[model samples]
Target: MGHINNKYYLGFEGEPEIIFTVVQKNNEKSEISIWSGYFNNIMQQITPVEGKWTALAYYYNLNIGWYDESPWLVDNIEDAYKQFKSIDKYKLDDLEEEILEEILELFKKSIEENNNVYISYE
Candidate 1:
């Protein structure tokens, strides 16, 4: 009934790189196609996300005000990029091109590593 009705985790080795959880919606739908469409759109840049998970925003929120030589610990090359970019940042909108690439790479790597990109509906 609604556009987005489920949660999806694009991850590798049991760790989620992209957590597309339903933050808001009008109704519920049992099908996962809706979410699949959303994922496809994000990958293709087909539509602006209204209220889905945002990888850049998450990095910003989780890294703001962090201290140390490096604010966050990174697990991979892409994550290192994200963590370094998120350092000393405050804005939520206007994601940088490099950060977007890292986010995209997260999913892409999941596929490259033979990891399932979708999690069960939430």
Candidate 2:
């Protein structure tokens, strides 16, 4: 059988409860989705319109969609936040915006608690 990557990752917020992503953690399961191709397609479309984010690698660092069964594991959550704070939310479609918001939220909690929240998929 050929290998198929069934799972991809999205980061989320801190609840001291979830085994979250490498860059961050979570409050709900729905917050952590497995979208192997969705981010590539959606982000590609959204990036150009949002120009501020089109070139930032750390922004992509928040979305580990390209890495199957691996976590992002960022060393500095605050730096990520500073770089990402300017992302224009209105440019994104509802779901995409929601995902960005969750990523930011997770970054905040991780920064506050000084802990790393990482996730992986099967």
Candidate 3:
């Protein structure tokens, strides 16, 4: 009953996928999950973290992450491809490369800054 939102899946290699939703003010469904090993690894490396990741806007707040809808919101593989093509010129392969680069850098930065990494649904 609201505006439709695009789903963004974020993850590191060899680990399970972690989803971060790109919410449209009025839109939304889907189940969201982060791997336990991934979560624990991050916590251990970051240590005694407080604030943001403290259950505020973090993924732990499941109330905002799920619904009875498709994860990609595409009804079928064919439709998914068509919709993806309509959105941008960049191929999914290109996007994957870019996302990986950025994510790797983010992980490095978190380690360097000793700051908690907060991947929130937005």
Q: Which candidate's lDDT is highest?
A: 2
* lDDT, candidate 1, 1-122, per-residue tens: 43442233332224423332121223232222222333333433422237542443343334331122222322233432343344432322233333444345544554355333222322
TM-score, candidate number 1: 0.23
Clashing pairs in 2: 12-25, 20-117, 20-118, 20-119, 21-117, 21-118, 21-119, 22-118
TM-score, cand. 3: 0.27
RMSD of each: 16.2, 10.1, 15.5
C-alpha lDDT of candidate 1 relative to the true structure = 0.33
Q: What is the C-alpha lDDT of each candidate?
A: 0.33, 0.47, 0.33
User: In model 1, what lDDT does residue 41 have?
Assistant: 34
Candidate 3 lowest-lDDT run of ten:
73-82
Per-residue lDDT over 25-59 for candidate 2, one digit per residue giving the tens place of the 0 to 100 score: 34322234535343443334433335454333434
Best first by TM-score, ranked: 2, 3, 1
Stretches of candidate 1 off by over 4 Å are: 1-44, 47-99, 119-122
